[model samples]
Target: MDLDVFVAAHRAEWERLDQLLRRRRHLTGAETDELVTLYQRTATHLSQVQASAPDPALTSRLTTLVARARSAVVGARKSTWRDAAHFFTAGFPAACYRTRYWWVPTGIVFTLLVAVIGWWIAGNPEVQGAIAAPEEVREMTREGGAYETYYTESPAAAFSAQVWTNNAQVAAISLAFGALLGIPVVWVLLMNAVNVGVGVGLMAAAGRLDVFMGLILPHGLLELTAVFVAAGVGLRLGWTVIDPGRRTRRAALAQEGRAAIGMAIGLAAVLFVSGLIEGFVTPSGLPTWGRITIGIVAEAAFLVYVFVVGRRAYLAGETGDIVEADRAAEAPVAA
Candidate 1:
């Protein structure tokens, strides 16, 4: 038997078993004994096989071992959305303490994004023109477009609406890009920032600073901050590779993917909710104080959710209240 195959496959299985075992908050003595005994048998056999000559029948034995391991650990891959709710529980939230620190990467990506977008858009005419809207935005100039009928007559609201629309796009891109790592994340941030920079620069140069302020400050801070946070999640994913010192990329990514997705999920919720407010309120002739108040309240809610949700998930996991693990552990062992 080629015992090597058995050793390799069994060790792989043990990794899964070990993960299941350690995730427990506390293990009963009997349960711990069972785990330790299994580990010892598996480890001893693996060592002897590695140290000695191969047994001709080892292949068949190892194949059997692998099948058993697969059956034993099948429960682990079943986590679904229902699992996400418990993430808010104390068992999980307390475990994800690090997500609170995600801002570091998000800020770096946001700043770098502004620099690249600024340089690129400075020279790109079409991009610059699209942004600056040299002639009352595209719709206003086109005699039949909705802007001509809707915004041209009401320039302040139209401009404000357009600004809000563009900003919303930026925030969505930031969060969506996190799934692809920070490459697209940074791209999203930089591109939007570039558009904003050029548009603002040209408009201000044309002595339309008043027009732009009325257009921008109403929703820019909350919108832009959400985008930054989303891209930060992407950065967090990409940096996982560079910093996953002892862990394999796959293992590290699985954990990071959750937080990253959580970040994106959080970002999307903020954008959608804020977009509603910006679209309806900002362009509706609301006072600056009212706009500021809406923006502040919305931003606060977003921050609380971002910090709170992941922390809850982490703590939930740490709680050691292992329903899934317990059920899997209780499965009948076949002869």
Candidate 2:
């Protein structure tokens, strides 16, 4: 089992495998067969060397050759525009449709929480005082005040980009940290709920509920929905950790995590549209009803995308995960 002897013996085969791999796309039928045969032989050589001589340099060379030959033999999946299209049209929406129960309930509970907080603040003088000084509250709720001017303070395009980046980060955080049992996701959602509640409460107390509605509804509808989707997916990830069902915890987490990543990408696009609405339509001179109508339409379209397009995709077996070919191979386990 002399290392040099082993290397010298297998060196020609390894080099041939490398050459075939380099021209893998143009290989003839016989060359392809040779490549597969060389790959198998090289893999065997690698195993023998590791077991017998264990020379680092020879092991490394054979490992690289075997890997390249394996790739040439098996073929690799490349990302294309079609892949992107499939993700948006089928993967993302189907994921949303599949997990609607989690997110739909999340949306409902979050809305109720915001409403309750707003109601408490509007009704209780103590709560109002605790939130801000009387004059500060007045400034925020007053016509043409801080609440309305915030959208217009920066250029529309810049504002929209900034908003999109911020929301995307939040969504990413929610999805990424979901494996931590969803604590961070809940915290993120709570913080948002509080902010919205404060705005709603102050405006309602000032009898400017209509003004608040006009300002928020245009973008809030879609914007909040995206957030809800992220949170729901995140919670689902956490729940997967708790109860992996028929699958092992590792397998369940891996599947849900990949789907969550896809959801994050899709939600970013969703947030971008809402950011545009918030920056332009929310601050534009359009009538309140018009702005709100535009928001409603955007939201309705998203719902239809989820329920109609997403449902069909889900029913057809899209789980918002990558294709099987792209997924990592899992080890077999006992039942």
For candidate 2, lDDT tens digit of each residue in 1-335? Answer: 87767677877888898888888889899998998888878777776766567788877877777666666766776899999999999999999999999899999999999999999999998899998888998888898889989988999999999999999999999899988999999999999999999999999999999999999999999999999999999999999999988766767888999899889889999999999999899989999999999999999999999999999999999999889766544434457
Q: CA lDDT of each candidate?
A: 0.53, 0.89
Error of 2 at 59 (Å): 16
For candidate 1, write residues 1-335 as lDDT tens digits: 45456556666656644554554347666665555556445544533553354465753454344344434434336667776665544333332245446654665656566555645554565665766465654432233433213333455545555655665566556545555656877666566766566545444444454455454555555676666665555666677867755544544665566555454444555556656665665666667677667777877665565457645555445421334333212211123
Top candidate by lDDT: 2
Q: Top model by TM-score, which number?
A: 2
TM-score of each: 0.55, 0.81
The 10-residue segment with the lowest total lDDT in model 2: 325-334
Stretches of candidate 1 exceeding 4 Å from the true structure: 1-97, 100-105, 108-181, 304-335
**Candidate 1 lDDT for residue 123:** 51
Report the Cα lDDT for candidate 1.
0.53
Total clashes in model 1, counting residue pairs 3 or more apart in sequence or in different chains: 24
lDDT of 2 at 152: 89
